[model samples]
Target chain A: MNSLKPFSLLKRIRERLDLQIALAILCLATAFLFVGGYLNYLRAQEQERTGVITMVREMVAVVEGNAAIAAYLQDLQLATEISAGLQSSRYISMVSIDIDGGGLVSTGAVQSGRSPDFVLELASPFSAAETVGSIKVYADLDYIEKLAASKGRSVVSGQLALLLLVSVAILWAVRVVVTRPLGSVVRQLKKINLSDEGSINQISTRSQDEIGYLADNINSMLSAIHAAYLSEAEQSRRIAQLERKFRLIFEGSHAGIVMVDGQNRLSLANQAFQSLVAHLDPHLDQQEPRPLSQLFYDPELVEGILSTVRENNASVFRDLKLAGEQEVWVRSLFSLIESQNSAEMGYIEVVFSDISDRALIEKHFEYGATHDQLTGLLNRRGGEARFRRQVEQAQSRAGSFVLCLIDLNDFKPVNDIYGHEAGDVVLKEISLRLKSALRADDVIVRWGGDEFVVSMLAQSSDAVDAVGRNLLSVFEQPVEIRPEVWVRVGGSIGIATSDRVGFSIERMVEAADEAMYIVKKGDKNSYQVFGDSVARSQSQA
Target chain B: MNWMIKAVWILLAFSGSLYAGDILVVVSKDSPVDTITKRELVDLYMGRSHSLPDGSPVMKIDAPVDSPVRAEFYQALIGMKVSEVNAYWARLMFTGRATPPMSVTKPEDVAGLLARNPSALGYLPEDSENEQLKTIFVIKEDQGAP
Candidate 1:
C-alpha cells in the first residue's frame, strides 16, 4: 500500500490541468516543428547547392587565360603545369586539357570519360576568336553535398530550439491565467457551509477574464442555494411549531378525540378518548390497536355514524347511552378526515364528550312537566296523555279497561274549616291510600280540585265493580290533618267500562261524571255504575 | 570649359604614346632574310619555332632585361607590357621544351652578335645606327596592321 501511494499521487498529478495543458501544447508544437523544420531544411539545402555551383564557376574563370595559351602552343609541359594548378582547389576533383591535334595533359586520376562540371573552350593567345582546345574541371559533388547537408541541419536545429522555448512559455502562461484560479475557486466552494448564518465567501480574482466571470456566477449561485436552504429550514421549523400547537389542542381537550383507520381499528387516541373508553370497559388495556367499535357499548351506533360520515363526507352527531350501572351518556361527533392523496383511504375522527349531567337534568325537567308537584302523581295533562295511550292499547288488542272518576263529598267545608295547608295534607293522605289500593301499573290522575281519576285494564263488568269498590274504601278512612285534628272526607265514585263507551277517554270520563253527580244528589259518599244508572232511571219512569 | 580642354589635351598626350611606335626587327646583313612578316618574326622570338620562314635554323637575340629599347620592341610587336612578356616566357621555361630569345645584357652587344652569325635574329629602335644588321620587319603600336 505504501509503495502504491506515490504511484497514485503521480497519476493524480499527471491528471492536473496545468500538466495536461502543457502536454497537449507540447504534442501540437512538436508536430508543427517537424513539418516546418523539414521545409526549412530543404530550402537551405537548395541554397547551399546553388552557392557551391557559383563558387565552382568563379574558380574556372580565374584560370581560363593560362589554359588557353598552353593549348595554343600545344606545349605538353605547359599544359601539364596548368592542370596541376587547377587541381589544387578543393572544389575541383580533376582537370584535363585537350590540345587540338596534340596529346591531352591531365591532373588527378582521370576516370572513364566522366563528364566535367565546367567546360571552357580555349581561345588562341594572339587572337580573340580562334578556337584552340578545351579545359574540363570536374567538381567534387560529394564534398558539395556534405557541405549543404551540414548547413541545412544547423538551420533546422535553430528552429527546433525556438519552438521548444515558445511551448514552455505558453504552458506557463496558461497555468497562471486559467488553471490556478479555477483550482482556488473550487477549494473555496468546498469550504462553504450552508447551514452557518454567515454569508458565503466569494472567490477573489483580479483578472477580468472568463475565470473572474465564472467566480461571479458561482457566487450568485451559492447565495441562491444558501437562501433556499435557509427558507426551507425556517418553513420546517414553523411546521413543527404548528404541529406542537395542534398536539396541545388534541391532548388538552375536554372532549375525547380518536382517529380510526378504514379497517375500524383505532390508529390514534388522545388521553381523554382513552379515559372515555375506560368508563365503558375498564378492563380493556391491550397496547396493540383494538377495534374502535369495541370501545363503545353499542357498536351499531358507531357503525351507523361511520357509514353516515363516509357516505356524506361530512360529520355525524349522535348521543350514545353507554352500558353500565352509572348512567353514562356521551355526545359523539364522527367526521371523515379526507385523504390528501387519491390512492389512500380516509380516516374517521371521532370526538366524545360526557353529557350524563345534562341528560339527568333534562330528565328531571321532563318528570316535573308531567307529574303533579303537590301529590307526586300524574296531573290532569299527564292523566290525559296516559288515558289516550291506554285507549290506543285497548283498541289495538280489542281489550277492555275501566275508567273511574271520583269526587270528594263535603271536601270544600273541610277546606273552609281547616286552612288550605290543612286541605293539602288531607289531599296527600288520600292520594297515598288510593295508590295503595290499586295495582302498581294502574293509571291515577288528579283531575280537578276535588276530583280524582283511576284507570285499570279490565276484561268484564265484575272486574270493573271490584276496582270501583276498592277506590271507595280509599275515601272511607279519615286522614289526620294535624296532631289531634282529623278530617273525614267521603268520595263519590262513578265507574265506566271501555266496552260500553268505546276507546274514547273523553266519552268515558263524561259518562262517569254524570253518574257521580247523580250519586252526589241522592246518597253522598256512595258508588255508581254509568250504565246501571240509566237503567235505574228508566225503571223509575 | 578651360579646365575641360586641359583635361582633353592631357588625355591626347597619353593616348599618342599608346598608339605610335618606332621599332624594327633585324638580322645580320649577310643573312638571306629580308623584310620578314610579323607572324614569322613572332614565331622565332616567342619560341613557337626555332627556324626562319625559309626553314633554316637560326639564333635569336634580345636586348637586356632593363633596356627601354627592348621594352618598346616587344610592346610594338605583341601589344604587351614588359612584365607580361616575362610571365608568358616563364610558363614555357617550366616545360624545358620551348625557350625564349637569348639576351645580350647590353644594347651595344646585339649588333656584334648578329654580325658574327648570318642565321641570327635581333630587334632595335628604328633610329639606331647599326649597319651590321638589316631590317626584316617594322614593328608598330598596332600589331594588327599588315
Candidate 2:
C-alpha cells in the first residue's frame, strides 16, 4: 500500500505535466512530419514523371537520324520503320513522323488527341541545316503517374514511421527522468506536519540535472515554511501566558480599576471596580454598561477630569464624593490608555481608591480652625471671618448692620473688692445674659478682659435704638457672683452702623470705641450711637 | 641486299600516304551536268531527290562497303562512319521509303558503271578518275576529316 501511494502520486503529476508535454510533442511532430512528408512525396512524384519523359526523349534521339533520312527521301516505308522502333519503349504510347511532302507515317496509332511529350525536328542526314520533317513522341502518362504515385506512397510511409519512432522515444525519456522523481518529492511533502517542529525532510534525487535542482529548491522552501510555523506557534503560546497573568492581577487587586471607551462608557470593570460601583448604587444594573460620569456626585467634575486627560494624555487625581444613600468618597485617578494602532480611538483607565475616613478627619480639622474654645462662639480670628461674610451679605443686599463695643463702667472696683474668682463669676453671668438677650444669628465675641464686641443686622435707626436699650437692660439686674453675695457691673456701650463705617471691620471697631468713650464720659452706665456730630468731632480730634 | 629491300618498302609506304587525299563525285562526260554542289550531291545520294537541280534524272552508284574510298567519301560528306551510313540505308530500304544506290566491288568498276549510263552519279578516288566520268564535286579529306 505504501508503494502504491507513491505510484498514485506519480500518476497524478504525470497526468498534469508529463502527459501534456508528451502529447504536445507528439501533436507538433506529427503535423510537421505530415507536411514535410507530403512535400517530399510531391518532389518524388515530379522526379518520377520527369524520369519517364527523359527516357522517351532519349529513345527518340536514337532513332532521329533514320527518321530524318526517311523524311528527306519522302519514303513512307522508312518513316514507318523508325516510328516502329521508337514504339518499342514502354513509356512511349505512340510515335509518328511527317514526310517532307506532307505525308504522315505513324506506328501504333495514326492520330493521338493529346500533345506529344517530345518533338524532335528532323534535319537532312546528308546536309546539317536542312529541315526535313518532325517526329513527335507521345508518352504513356497513365503508366508513369501510377509508377510515381507508388514511389511517393512508399517514401511518405517511411518518413511517417520514422517520425512516430522519434516521438515515442522522447516521450519515454521524459516520463523516466522528470515526472517520477518530482512525484516522489511531492509524496514526501504530503507526509510533513509542520507544527511538530523538525518534521521537514529533504527531497532525494540521484540525477544531477534540472530535476536535482528542483528537489533542492523544494527542500529549501519546506524548511522556510516549517520555520515560519514554529515561530507562529511560539508567539501564540507566549501571548496566552501573558494574558493569563494580566487577568490574575485585574481580579486580585483591591483598588477599583475600570477601562472606559471614548464615549465615557465603562468597557471593562474589574471586581474591585464593580464593588465600588455597587457601594455607590446598590440597585445599579450590572448587566448593562453605565457611563463613568454617573458614578460621581458631580457629573461636571467628572467631565472636567476627562477633558483634561484627553488634552494632556496625563493622569488626573481627584478625591470625589460619590452619589449614594451614604456618603462614599473615592480618590479617582484618570489616565489615558493609549491605543496601539494610531487609527483606533483611545480609552481611559480609571483607578478609584476609597478615602472616606481621611476625608472625615480633615473636616474636623477645618471646623477647629475657625471656632473659639472658651466662649463656644467665634473668636476674634473666627469673628473676623464671620464679619467679612456678613459684610459681603450686607453689600449684596444693600442693607446695614450695627457693631457694638461694650466696656464695663464699675468692673475694675468690683474686681479688686471681690477678688479674681468673683470677677470671673460676674463675667460668666454677663455672658449668659448676652446670649439670652440676642437673636440666634447674631455674632458675639469677647474682645478682651472687661470688653465685648457684638454685631447684628439692623436696617433702620429705630431698630438700632431698640437693640441699644435691650443691651443696657442686660446690666439692669445685678448678677449673683457667689451663692450669697450680689454684685452689679454696668456696661457703657457704643454702636457704629456698617453704612456709617463703610464695610471695614477695623474702622467700624475704632468708631464704636470712640463712641463708648463719649458714653463713659457722659453717663456711667448707658449706650450711645455715633451720630454725624460725634463722627465730625472725632474726625477733627 | 637487305638495305635495297628496305628502300623499296619505304617507297611503297610513301605512295600509300599520297593516296589518302580526296574523292571526287563524278558523272559521265556525255551527261549534261556541268557542275554540282555538296548539297545537290547529298540530295541525290541520300535519296531526298532522284533528279538533279537542273532536272536531269540520274542513277546513283556506290563503292563497296569495305572500300577505303567509300569510307573516306561518306565520312567527308556527312561526318558518318560507313557502318552508320549502312544503317541509315537499311532502315530506308526495309520501310520501303527509298532504295539505296547500287554498289560496285572494285574501284575500277565505278568508272565502268558511270560509263554505261549518262546520268549516273558515283564517287571514286581522286587518282582513279578518267575522261569517261567527269568530276563534278570533290570530297576533300583534310577539310572534312570527321
Candidate 3:
C-alpha cells in the first residue's frame, strides 16, 4: 500500500467534516439504542417477576378464603351438611374438617398423600362457648401459573419490540444529525487545492458549531498565507531587480567595486578586484573573495591597508602588491557605507581598479563568477544567496509555499551511454521543460549537473503536485539529441509544502530531496511530496 | 297381511329385548380406568368433585366423535351440551399443559381397546362386553342407586 500521506488525509477529512459528524451521530444513536434496549429488557424482567409474585399472592388469598369457610363449616353442628354445601363450589379442589384435638375428622373425596403443589390454607373457627374445629382448603395453582406465564410472555415480547423500533429510530436520527453534516464538510475539505493562488480563500463553512469556527480560522489562515505569498513574490521580484542593478553597476562603473565588512568579510567583488589580482593569480576566477592578507605577499602591506581604512573612517586609496610570486599593479579604495539599521559602523566598500594590461582578462573572469555557464540558470552560490533572501521575505509575510528538488532520473545513463554532449543537450531540454512548467512567480535554479531546485509561491500541496505532474508529463516524451540516437530520461521530483513542512528553506529542500528519491523508488516518472513518508525514506537513506 | 303382522311382532320383540337389557352405562376402552358408583360418575362427568373416596385417578370418556349418545351422556351427567364439552377441551388444550381424554371413532373400537388394556376403562352397552374386561363399578341409568 502507498504510505499514508497524513496531510492529504487531514485535508480530506477536513473537507468532509459533515460525513465525520454524521458517522459520529450514527454511532451515538446506535449506543443509545443498545442502552435503551437493555433498559427495556430490565424493565420487562422486573414486571414479569412482580406479576408472578402477585399471582402467587392472589392464589394464597383464595386458598386462605377457602380455608376460613371450611373452618366455619366445621364449627357448625351440621358439619357434614356445611362441608357438602362447600363442595358445590367448582373452584375448591379439596375441603377437610378437623376437630380441635382430633386430626382430620372428615375430608372430601380428594386424596391427601401427595405433596400439595397448589395453594393450601388451614383455619379454625370458634363457637359462642368453646373453640370448635379447623378446616383446610386447597386452591389449584395451575390456573395462576398459566395466567402469569401468558401475561409475562406478552409483556416481554411487546417491550422487546418497542426497544427494537426505538433503536432503529435513534440510529436514523444520529445519521441525520451528525453523519450527514460531517460528510458534507469532508467533501468540501477534499476539494481544497493548496496550489491555486486564490483557492484557500474559497473555503466556506456555514455551520454555527465548532467545525464552523474551525472553518473560519482556516479561512483567516489561508488569507494570511496568501498575503505572505504575495509579499514573498514581491521580495523575489525586488531581489531580481537588485541583482540586475548590481550587475549593471559592476560592469558599467569605471571604478572597481570591492565591498568588505569590518570583519574582513568580502560583501561584493566587482570587475576591478578580479583585474587587480589576475596577474598575481592567473586563475583569479577560481579565487573567490580572496582575503586582503592572501592578496598581498608582504604582511606589512596588508597591515598598512587595514590601518588606513580603520583610522581614516573615510575613503583610503593605496597602492597594493600582488599577494604571491607574480607581481601585479593594484589600486585599493576603501569607504564605509552607513549601516541600514543602526549607526554602528557597517562594512567598508573597497574599490580595486586595475590600471594594468591584465584588466581585460579579469573582466572576463568576473562575468563567469556570477553567470551560470550552462543553461544560464543561477550558479550554486548565487542561487543560495538569492534563495536565502527570498526565504527571509517569505518568513516576514508568513505565506504558503513549496520547495521542490528535481533530479533527472536517467540523465546518468544518457551521459554514460551517449556522451557528455548528448547529456548536456538532455539537461538543457529538461531545463526548458522545467521553466515552461513553472509559473512566472516560481524560481528554477540548476543546482548543478542533473539536479535543479524550484521554489513556488503556491497556496497548497495540490498546487505543488500539479506543477510536479506537469514537469513529469513534459519529460515523458523522449528527447531526440540527434536524428539517429534518441535519449529517453525521466525526472524524479520531490515537493515540500510550506504550510505542512514549515518555512525553513533547508528543511524544505531536504524534505523535497527525500521525496524525490521516493519518486525514483516508486515510479520514476512521478513526483513525491516531501515529508510524506515516501520522501522521508529517501532522506533517511 | 300375514307378513306385515309378523314384521310388527319382530319389531316388538327387538324393542322388548332392548328394554330388558338394563340400560347399563358403557364407557369406551380408552377412558381412564376408574371404578365409580352412579353418584360419583354423575358428579365427575358433571364437573363436580368434592373429593375422591377411593382416591383413584378418574377420567371420563364419551361415545364416538359425533355420536348422539355422547351428547346425551354429557347432558345427563353435566347438564351441558356436547358443544360445551368441546369448548371446554379447546380451552384446556389452549393452555398446552393438559390434554382431554383420548377419543375413538367408533364404540366398538373403544370396546376393543378397553379389552386389550387393563388401564383402559369405559362404560359400554351392558350386553356388549365379553369376559376380557371387568366392570368394577356401575352407574345406574336412574339416580336411584348411590
Candidate 4:
C-alpha cells in the first residue's frame, strides 16, 4: 500500500506553479501513448491472424492428395496421419480431417486461439472434381495476449517517463523564474534599516524582469521616504532655532513687547513690557500677570486698539499715554500675526515705547519747518505747501477762497533811514494785523521782505475787498520806528480768487502780485482786487 | 482468341502458368442464353455491369470453395486466386451484397441444380456434355504452343 505521502506531495505540487504545465504535457504524452499502443496492438493482432490463416492453409495443402486417396480407398490411417501432422505448428493446437463417405480422423482437443477455431476446406487433389474432406486447425492466442501486454507496458512506461521528465523541467523553471528571485527580494527587504549609519536605500539588482522593476520601484520609494524624513527633520530644527532667536530678541528688545493669542488672552510679555505695566500701577500684584488693558490709562484705549486690529488687522495708536504718575507717552503698533499656512492659528503683537520726549521735540520741529521764525506766521516755502492743501480742500469741497498779497509802501526808505530795525518791526506788525483780521480758518504768510500774503475763505468777493481796504488803512496810524521817531508806512494789497478764470496756485499768486503792482503804481498804499481789476479792465475796454 | 481467354484472368496472376485446358461454360436449358461468348461470360462472373443480350440478370454459380473446378473457373474468369475470390465475397457478404452461390458436393449435381433453377449458371470440363444444361462457351488448352 502507498503511504499518504504521495497525496501530500500532490497537494504540495498543486500549490506550486509548475504542476499545471507539467500536467498538460503529461496528458498529451499519455494520449499519444494510448493511441499508439492501441494501433500497435491492432496491427500485431492482424499479423498474428494472418500468420495463423497462412499456416493452416499450408498444412491443408500438404496433405490434400493423401486425403483424396484416403477418401477414394476408405482408408482411416491416411486421414489420421494428416490430422496428426497439424500439431507441429506453434499456433495450431488441434487438427481434424473428415473424408467424405470414407472415415473421420482427428487429433488433440481444439483448445486454442478463438473459440470457433480456424477451419480450412480442403479440395481433393484431382482433376475428377471430387469433394473429399475438410480440415480444422485451432490457433493459439498466447502470442496476441503477450504482444498486447508488452505493448501496453511500453506505452505506460513511456508516459510515466515522459511525465517525470516534464515535472523536473517545470520545477527547475519555476525555481529559476519565480521562487529564487522573490526570495532575493524578500531578503533585500529584510536588510532595510533606517537608523543604521550605512544602510542601503536602493536595491542593487539590475535585472530587467518584473521582479527587478518591482525592486527598483521599492528602492526609489524608500529613497523618497528617507529624503522626506531628512527634510522634515531639517525644517523642524530650523523652526526651533528661529523660535529661540525670536525669544531672545523679544526679551532683549528696548521696546515693550506684548503678544496676545487668537483667544484675546495675553500669551507673552517681555521684561520691558512687564516693568512698564508695573510702572502703570505701583500697588499691582507681582505674582500674577496683569491684563493688557490695565497698563493703559483707559480701558477703552485697549478696546479701541483691539477693534482696530480686528477691523483693519493692523493699526498704530500714536501718543498713547501710559497710566503712570510720570506721564509716559508711548506709541504702539498692533499687528495680527497670521500662521504660515494661513490656518486659524495666529496672535496679535504690540510693540510700544516711550515717545513723550521725542514727541515734544518733533512738535517743535514741525512748527519750525512751516512757520516764520520771527513773526510766527507761515513762511513762503511752508505757506505754499499749505496753499496747495487749501486748494485741494477748496476743489474737493467746492468751496471758494481768495489769495491776497500785501506789500508795505516805501518800506526800503524806512529801512535805510532807521537802520533796518524799523522795517523789521513794521513787517512783523503787518503779519500780526493780517492774522487778527482774517477768519480763524484763514492762513497768513510772510511773503518775505516787507510783504505778507493771506488766504481767506469767503462767501462773496466783496468780503475780500473789505479785507483789502482794512489792510490799506492799517499804516494810517503807524508812527514809531524807534520810540518817538515815527515813519508812516501804508500797504498796497492785491487779491485773486477761484471764482476768477485760470485758478492754479502759481497763476493766482501771479495775478495777485500783478494787482498789487497795479495798486503800487496807481496809488501807493491803496488795494486792487483781481476780480475788481478784471471788471475795471473790461469796463475800460 | 482461345489463348487470350485462358490468360485473361489466370496468366495475369501466374504469368508462366500452363494453359487452361478443357474449361466449358454452361447454363440451364431454360436460360435465355443458348450460348454466350467467353468475354461476355467473364463480364457476368466478375460483376461488371453488362446485361445479357436478352436483358436478363445473371444467376452465376461456381463449385464448392475448395473445388478444383472452382479454382479453374476463377483462373479463366478474372485471373483471381481462389482465396482472393473468397475475400472479395466476404467483403460483399457482410455488407448484404450478392451472396455466393450454394455449394454442391457431387459433379453430377451441377447439371441437376442448373436444371432445377433455370437462371443457374455453372462450368464443366470441356470433354463432357450434359443433357440438362447447355454449354455457352469453350476454353481450349494451349496444345499448339512451341
True contacts kept of 2: 0.92
Least lDDT summed over 10 consecutive residues: which range in candidate 4 chain A?
Answer: A532-541
What lDDT tens digits, residue by residue, belong to model 4 across residues B1-146? 99889868675567443334667778887888887775566545644323575787766667766766677777666566789867755644433323455567776677777888887778877766878778877765542111
Q: Give candidate 4 regions above 4 Å deviation.
A: A1-358, A459-463, A479-487, A531-541, B1-146
Q: CA shift at A373, candidate 4, in angstroms?
A: 1.2
lDDT of 1 by residue, A431-471 (tens): 99988898887899988898899997765667866676677
Per-candidate clashes come to: 0, 2, 40, 4
TM-score of model 1 relative to the true fold? 0.47
TM-score ranking, best first: 2, 1, 3, 4
The TM-score of the first chain in every model comes to 0.48, 0.57, 0.46, 0.39
Considering the two chains of model 1, state its CAPRI-style docking category: acceptable
Q: Give the best candidate by TM-score.
A: 2
Docking class of 3: incorrect
lDDT of 3 by residue, A224-266 (tens): 8877887788899999999999799886787767666565655
The lDDT for every candidate, in the order shown, is 0.80, 0.80, 0.61, 0.69
Q: Could you tell me the C-alpha RMSD of candidate 4 in Å?
A: 24.4
Per-prediction TM-score of chain B? 0.78, 0.83, 0.59, 0.70
Which candidate number would show the highest DockQ if scored against the true structure? 2
